[model samples]
Target: MSEQPVPVTTLLDDEAFLGTYQPDIWVFVQRSLIIGFLTAVVFGPLIGLPPEYWLPIMGFTTVFSAFIFDDYTSWLNHRADVWHLTSLRLIYENGNAPEQNAAVNLADIHATQRKLYKNLRLDLETGQSVLMKYLTNPRAIERDIDIARLALMGTIADEADIPTAEEANS
Candidate 1:
């Protein structure tokens, strides 16, 4: 007889996993480009190098700026930060440390707002707000949060009770 593989379960197995969100890649690219360009423009001439060597100096400064600002600093700070949406709660994890994690019950979220271009603010009933930065399509995430919140509160209609597109048209 062939041996059967056992099913693996995790601590979160009881909750339905909805989505996982991380900082947008475009935020990194944009920051790197802006910082690199500004560093090259400002420091290239300040070095008082020969014209022939100025191009190489600028290139080096730009690369160094990108490495220092984006790769080393920003990436180290935000790379491990992630938000997970589940049926019961929203979980935030920072870095690889288990102690640096938090979860808020969906019922506790009073509202969600999209701030600037990519930031999401979650206002809790207790008057505390959590900010999620550099998310891609934060508007969609906001909508999803609203939907989940309403569903949890038993406000959404059943799918069977809703009319299909064709039925509505007819």
Candidate 2:
């Protein structure tokens, strides 16, 4: 059978030598945008009316807040960091934004777990992990780690070959 093509992963931060992938906050941005537009429609016109149009005024303010808040949040999320796994190791870097980074050897990794929710979190045996709740592409990130884990296991097939010098002495 022919081997399938491997997908390409990208870096996401610079502040950290290595960083984990995070999901985008697009959903949050979209929701905020909708609320802003709704408020404008309901109150923008009434703001010019009598002082008794306080309801409209409040709506207008809400819309304005949503627009400003969502815009900034989305803008920031666009700069989220990313995590990647190669055949030999895991890498954390800035996808488009700058953040601290680090790299952990796959041989040292003990386990990896993916937590799915409003945000995705990756727990690694390396004791170092990242929490990216607002990242845009979480599935891809998890997939990368899973691939790495598989590759790692393949490299150390025999229990005698597993790295245990440090732990055994301790």
Candidate 3:
């Protein structure tokens, strides 16, 4: 329930660093550029544009637009989209307003399903599910969530409950 500054990495309302849930920002940027490149290759000539000139332009536009969109959404979700967890709760904000947030008590989490590419779907006791998608490190997030669960239940986590030191440091 107390705020902590994580230097260059994170800023949250009042949450200590349990863990974070975010995708690599570059991944979305790269995907957008790739889509633009493919579009230029497939559609540029049909629109009477030369591939050589069109490719870069299209790609640049795609990446730029993607960056803008991503930035805006990231900005919106800064409070929530990328979770900054604490011992007692997972706090997230997803909009321009102060009231726009979704905080889940660690105790309400019933189960979680994780997929490759860093997607985690958490089932809550309320029968609602929350999906934290495109995380850069799903397993680490899961580990921390598990730890939070134990902590919320008034249990202490042993070394075996967390990621190895090497993995966590990285």
Q: What's each prediction's clash count?
A: 0, 32, 3
Q: Tens digits of per-residue lDDT for model 2 on 36-142?
A: 55665666565565545655555565566756556455446544455555655566565454445555566666544445433455555666665655545555555
Ten-residue stretch with the least lDDT total in model 2: 10-19
Q: What order do candidates take by lDDT, descending? A: 1, 3, 2
- CA deviation > 4 Å runs, candidate 3: 1-17, 29-80, 95-97, 155-157, 161-170
Per-residue alpha-carbon lDDT of candidate 1 for residues 73-148, written as tens digits (9 for 90 to 100): 6656676677878777888877656576888899999978788657789999999999887776787787677677
For residues 139-161, write the lDDT of model 3, one tens digit per residue.
77777787777767866667465
Colliding pairs, model 3: 79-93, 80-92, 80-93
Model 2 compared with the native: what TM-score?
0.43
The whole-model lDDT of each prediction reads: 0.71, 0.52, 0.65
Q: Pick the candidate with the highest TM-score.
A: 1
Tell me the alpha-carbon RMSD of every candidate: 8.9, 11.6, 7.7
Best-to-worst TM-score order: 1, 3, 2
**Model 1: residues with Cα > 4 Å off, grouped in runs:** 1-14, 31-75, 158-170
Q: What TM-score goes with each of the models?
A: 0.61, 0.43, 0.54
